[model samples]
Target: MKTAKILKVATFFSWFACIGLTIKSGAILVTYLLSISNPEASKNMYESLNLFEYYNHSFLNYSIIVFYKIVLFSVEAYIAYLVIQLLKKLNIKQPFNIDVHSLMRKISFAIFYLWIIAIVHNTHIQIIGKKHNFELSLFSSDFVFLSLVIFIFAQIVKRGIEIQSENDLTI
Candidate 1:
């Protein structure tokens, strides 16, 4: 009961954060596009985000950064949505249903995809850092382990669901 309450609260907060991030990203993107079209607004809007601090002159770099941001935020939002769905499943009477197992696998897959995207993004940043003479924090060991753990948990849930179904059918 307590855990369900906690999960409900967390889901709400995470949803709020995800929505805020989406709005923020959209605003920044709009500002960036406006900066490109209008000379007067360009100076403030372009410098507002400082996204192109490393390579201000290269349009390709700017586009890549914007694209990366969009992908990252979209992935994050999807993860949050998955969490909400997972929580909803957990709070239900039949939490061990096939839908719950499916949600677990979906979350795991989402995290895996996010990991792959992050690697590409980090590599791009590192390459830019190398050329521009800047340092990057790079990947965190904690994140790697967390993602693997989540994936393992998802597999466990899937296996549990299979066993549960089997038990239900047996006399």
Candidate 2:
């Protein structure tokens, strides 16, 4: 009963999170397009890019860094969507449903993908961000451990579904 109530809350919160993140993504898209045309748009976006500190900002360099930021935010929005799906699956009464296991697996995969994107993105940022004296967290061991745990939990969910199905057959 307690778990069900918690799942219900999580499902609704996930919906809210998904909507908010999608809106933020759309706003970033608008800003990115606008930044292409207006000179001031570049300045506005350069709020903290350290453009002049390390090297002069060329349109090409500014554009690449901006695009990378947008991609990173888009990944965050995608992860939110995956979380919503996982939460909704958990909201279902049947804890051993195959769909639940599938959602967990998808969530784990999304996390792994996000982890990879971060590493690759930060690598470029390090080469560039460091040149400008920008603060950067290039990698996270916390994420590494969490990703492994989530992936293992997904496998456990898969095993639970199989066991439930076998139990159903016997009855």
Top-lDDT candidate index: 1
Candidate 1's error at 14, in angstroms?
Answer: 2.4
lDDT of 2: 0.65
lDDT of candidate 1 over 38-85, digit per residue (tens): 534433432354544543656677567667766766777887888778
TM values, all candidates = 0.80, 0.79
Q: What Cα-based lDDT does every candidate model obtain?
A: 0.68, 0.65
lDDT of 1 at 112: 76
Query: In order, what is each prediction's RMSD in angstroms?
Result: 3.2, 3.2
Give the TM-score (vs. native) of candidate 2: 0.79
Please give, for residues 1-171, the per-residue lDDT of candidate 2 as tens digits: 788788778768877777776666566556657766655554443333333322244566656655666666666667677777777666355777777778777777777777777777677768866776665534342455667788899899889888988998999
| Ten contiguous residues with the weakest lDDT in model 1 | 38-47
